[model samples]
Target chain A: MAPNGVNGSSGSHRFDPDFTRLVVENMGPNVAPRTRQLLGGLIRHIHDFAREVELTNDEWMAGVHFINSIGQCSTSIRNEAHRVSDILGLESLVDEIAHKLVVEGDVEPTSSSILGPFWSPNAPFRDLGSSIIQDPNPKGRVALMHGTITDLLTGKPIPGAVFDIWQASANGKYDFQDPENQTPNNLRGKFRADENGKYWFYCYHPTAYSLPTDGPAYKLLQLMERHPMRPAHIHIMVTHPDYRGCTTQLYPKDDPWLATDTVFAVKNDLVVDFKPKEGDPKATLDLEYNVILPPKDYKGKL
Target chain B: MAPNGVNGSSGSHRFDPDFTRLVVENMGPNVAPRTRQLLGGLIRHIHDFAREVELTNDEWMAGVHFINSIGQCSTSIRNEAHRVSDILGLESLVDEIAHKLVVEGDVEPTSSSILGPFWSPNAPFRDLGSSIIQDPNPKGRVALMHGTITDLLTGKPIPGAVFDIWQASANGKYDFQDPENQTPNNLRGKFRADENGKYWFYCYHPTAYSLPTDGPAYKLLQLMERHPMRPAHIHIMVTHPDYRGCTTQLYPKDDPWLATDTVFAVKNDLVVDFKPKEGDPKATLDLEYNVILPPKDYKGKL
Candidate 1:
């Protein structure tokens, strides 16, 4: 017979509903309301998912290991896990999904994405018509980019909008993540548009690059037998206190991997032509970027 | 109009199904069959969970942070995150539910709980008739414990089983984690049963204690509004060269926390009575214990 405990408190082994009750009864007494709500929703979702999958022990442990490696691979130069997020298109889908909600500026679309592992606090400021490129060591043809940022409805430029841009060099490397390159900042700079919402910059045509395939995310990809390439693009973060902040990338027209960018950041409104200037002594390019400010007196914002 | 890329690649962004596809596809390469199967299944479960909850960006980031704190909370004496697991009952549920499926052998009829963060590898081995207590602290009335390891089918006692027992003092502190009290080996030991499947030891009755709540797990629980207490119990890791391994615990009968053990470790067959025996020399002692052996022909198989 199964052993019995004092006062007959222990009897047949049975599933206690206590687990569910305990969890609900014990979480978050001091958290902010929004955070509490978010955590509560997350716990519910995770629990429901576990139930739906009937996840096993080994499988759960594997998730633990995968997450562990994500932590290990997070360095100043690389965030392999974030790269995985990009490859999965989580960053693009959640942050860059343009909708009526965003265009109407019902919610302030703060720049959101993986905060890619390579970002640093040191970004030198440049003028409206300044060249961001320093030491043009493996330089390609120079291109001049111009854009007019205006209120979507009024077609008026939101002068003085700060435009931050960075891109892969012709050799497919960002200045921060690559250590072999010089340190003073290359292919990355911040620019301000003039009062007319007009601006231009001198930089080489960006090239396509492969996401890092040497870390745990790579191990994961190898385990799944998948590719690790992203389309050619220039990374940009557009921000101002008044208008919604936008973190996006502009994809080049002729990159072979455009359709398969590991981060899935290509957005139609964001992509612009990097036209080749014909013997005009200058590579002139022009595009219009509109910013829609949040409406006055509206409170339910993102 | 939605702008198009020069190469005519559609830049229109939407939440693509390809995101989920890429996540599963890029996990790990050529792992063990069992590992691959497990990770693959888990990835699917996490994905489904995220979708079912319509997981938002903010919520997902919270999960990442929660996990990060869990890792941060891990130390030599505390692992509150695991306690969070215990409080959620995931630890006990997993231990009891899926352990056999992954590795099967001598199944212990008793209930098992989490391996709390305090167990140390330096426990001093004690002989059969010795007290587990070395320090004069957390005193409780000593009582003799006796039992026979018999087969449920045959009702025959099995001899030569080794039973390892460890528990906190009456004050709820394990020796190693408590620096204010005493030296290394205190209130902890291991005992082996004789040919009759019988053994005894010395120690006061274990008392319930709150789990470590000063770390990140505590912060999480505070956020979750939960307590950090576990019911009184004695851990038993029973093994014999020929019998199946059983790592379990015996909880006290009248524990107030029985219904609410933070780690969800209460099992039905695992509870044992601490009867107050009639006035005898053994009854006045500081500690007393007993043991039972495994079945014959039960070679230790993992």
Candidate 2:
């Protein structure tokens, strides 16, 4: 029989008596209620995992050392812990849980997606429809993208919504990754919607890219015999005074890796077509998308 | 309905569809069978815990940053990750699982305990019955501890058994912790058993001590309103050519924190009395203990 509070209807295994007690009652009296709850569940699950596998001492030590190495590998330029989480699908999982659709009456909130590891707070704000690809020797077809932001419940345009947009170049490199070839803030821009709640930008077509392979995250991927590619996509974050902020990504519909993105951030609703344009001399492709945001007064559990 | 391959009889919670798929099918084709099994259960439990609490994005980010800080806090002299595991009761749990008692034909094995974080591999060797407390101004009552190592199955002396012993000073400090006052290897010694499996050592009585409070581990303790004291005990590791190695600790019977040791390393069978001696010229107290070891051929699951 399983020990009391060990399995506790959340697992189907028995544990040593002392371990069970430690997991069930180790919390101190002064811990906040929410902290207590979070820790209790975390402890139980970790203990259960150990028991389920009958983990050896050497294995446990290896895990300890692995965590230490990850710490040692981190620097201001790289976050190995975040990379580990991304490869393990934890970041995507957290995003899905924290940003579930908010329903107020009959309105549907915009779909949420991964913030990924490349977001920068210093993206330069630009005028509407300005070219974000400032490099003299750009490598991809030019595209015109436009989007509008609206309040979900009121169906009214949220004028002056700020849109922060960024993506990899056609060569699958972000600005930071190719400092010698790409100017600072290349392929990254922040634009404000006009009085009609519509915003537009000119940039090169984004492409699929593999994560850095020299790091521990990619090493794990190699060990698992898995790919490191994220799908062709563009990232966008919209914010307005009267609405809750929305951070999301837009994937090309025809990208072969859409269903198998290593980060698991893709959703069917977030995929769009990059259609060919006929009448623009400076742009070869055009795409249109719209976003809906929850009202600031929305009171709903996430 | 619960998703397939997720919490399938092991847990009692529902998960987001994508999260469930990631937990169930995230392993790659090249992953070892054992690794796949371990990771499957681990992913499932982590997801369940997140869903159970509706973990917020801020909380998730906080956890990520906390882990990174633990990594950054580590050094050659300190392992903050290990310290975190120790305070969370994970080290004790792993010890209990890895060092289970071994029972052979008609023989009961000796009880095992934690090796703790203070052990050093550079202890000096000494003759039988040597005084380990070489400090000229020792601060506590002197004690003589003697023990015999015998084969559990036959109750016969195990010749040439080596005993490695260490303990904190009466002032509740280890040699390394007070280098300004204590010699390099004070209070640490190794001795070999006689033909009769007998060994003895002289040392000062140990007192309960608190862990370092300035690091992240103790900061967590403070936040949880928990004390950081470990019960008074002497650490020992016994090894013989014809028997498996045993690492354990012996606790005094009268320690105030015996039942509430912060590390939870105390076992009922490992606690002993420290009796006062009437006329010991070199000692004020005496304690006698015995250890039983399984034969070299003993085979048991841990």
Candidate 3:
């Protein structure tokens, strides 16, 4: 007898409709259930896409060549695949799906956003309220950013929540992208909330910037006639030993590209105002935001 | 006022249901009409797939990394992207869709098949009845393959139709794959039909072979619990000046893997019998087949 899940006996496979079924059936029996489901869905959808387009052989070969060129263009410093995902807005879509809030009782979870490609694991640890900007003569407006991490269920501060933050400089470049002047760990830092769950940092206000357009990603954008600009934003990942972690971005209100972020990462709840300081000349701007975390006992969607 | 195909005002673009539309709208104005249709369909389907799967951020990242790895593994000699397409049976699907016969006025077209990856443009030109096998003491059964190229409309022989043929050795390896022993262009030749539309050549009977399993394509098959073997077949491309070219393969009728060709390239019409030579002891087997071509004026779905 034929094995379970095998579409038909070996002799019965045909090209019309059975070909797809045969391809799916031939998948290894040992594949994990989730993997099987994902692969099956992917294959089915891909086949449907091909059929819907009535994809010609020349078009198929063109796609193959395009993918190969994407591969050829990738390197240690340049990730063409990641750029492709960004250009397609798939990364943001995945983020949105993966981080849906599941409310329990009265708890309200903080919104999550895209953890963009600029994140580095080596951000320096700094004291709360310390300046993250190391450059003495920075070109952008200085901002004081303050926030508190609290447990949504208990409505109490999470005293020791750690915040990993990074953002682009005034000239719209990350530290690694501008090695000529910016020192290591510039505009990136790790800090812990105080006993009152308060955290603050001084940094330059991030400026909106265009994505790298020299590679396949840019080529795609050019083909799409789409602008590659990302709105001004600061990235942060908040984590606590007892609560679920959150990776998000704080978009500045009124940014021209806010609605048209090339990566499609903006969320209304994640937008914040970067208000100009009223009295302090030294502080060019101030931002007050808060983060709410799910409790350790919470068992809901991330 | 917005441009012709722009979905909305610049500031109105959002990430909810509108994101997909924005992406489709942003496609460059100069894109060919067909390309726009294809890309638009692709973006919609990809977005739909992500939504259907509820693709997680981690899963998305994993896919990105996987694609990058496939790219990194590609070289001048190996195309991992094409291998992935083959393993997914995408290549065969494209072939099926692309080579559909567009019949006109009782014209019968030759069956088309997948163009397997081993074909090289460097096959040496040889006269009709030439021996493609250069290995003096080849260890496989010697076979005499003869074919006729005819016009589908007239059913008359089309003289001077060029045929490019290639196949693996009995050891299930191609000349390029067994460079340590096999000479360049072994079992590969370019021949033309005579005035009577007859062509013949001698070669070893091909053996079923496994695809290269060290790459991502094989890894996927292994995960799917599928074998990577392609059925024994001879690759052929016949082209006449007045006809549309035909790229196809002739599968042995009794090959064990014919029913389960790893690439799903097998079709009943493309299968031919490899009969044992009745009287000639020198020729172990013989294959007689004919090819039909559509006139250049014939234009249909394919």
DockQ each candidate and list the results. 0.19, 0.43, 0.37
Cα misplacement distance, residue B57 of candidate 1 (Å): 5.0
Q: Where does the lowest 10-residue lDDT sum fall in candidate 1 chain A?
A: A1-10
Candidate 2 docking: what grade? acceptable
**Local accuracy of candidate 2 as per-residue lDDT tens digits, A10-93:** 444433555655544756787898887776666766776676676777777777776777767778877887877776767777
The top-ranked prediction according to TM-score is 2
Candidate 3: list runs displaced more than 4 Å: A1-15, A102-108, A153-156, A296-302, B1-16, B102-108, B122-124, B299-302
TM-score, model 3 to reference = 0.88
As for candidate 2, its interface RMSD to one decimal place is: 3.2
Clashes of each: 23, 2, 6
Clash pairs of candidate 2?
A10-B11, A11-B10
- Which scores greater on TM-score, model 1 or model 3? 3
Residue-level lDDT tens digits of model 1 in A187-266:
88888878886667777677777777677666766665566777766667766666665666666677776665556555
Instruction: Give candidate 2's whole-model lDDT.
Output: 0.78
Q: Summarize candidate 2's per-residue lDDT along B1-302 as a digit string, tens digits.
A: 22224343334443355565553575667788887776676666676667667677778777777677777888887788887777777777788777665453655677788787688899999998779987845458888999899987789988789998889888888888888778978899999999999999888777889888877788777656678888999999999888978889888999988877777778887898999987878899998888888877777643
Q: How well does candidate 3 score on lDDT at residue B236?
A: 91
Docking class of 1: incorrect
lDDT of all predictions, in order shown?
Answer: 0.57, 0.78, 0.79
Total clashes for model 1:
23
- Alpha carbon deviation, residue B288, candidate 1 (Å): 10
Better of 1 and 2 by TM-score: 2
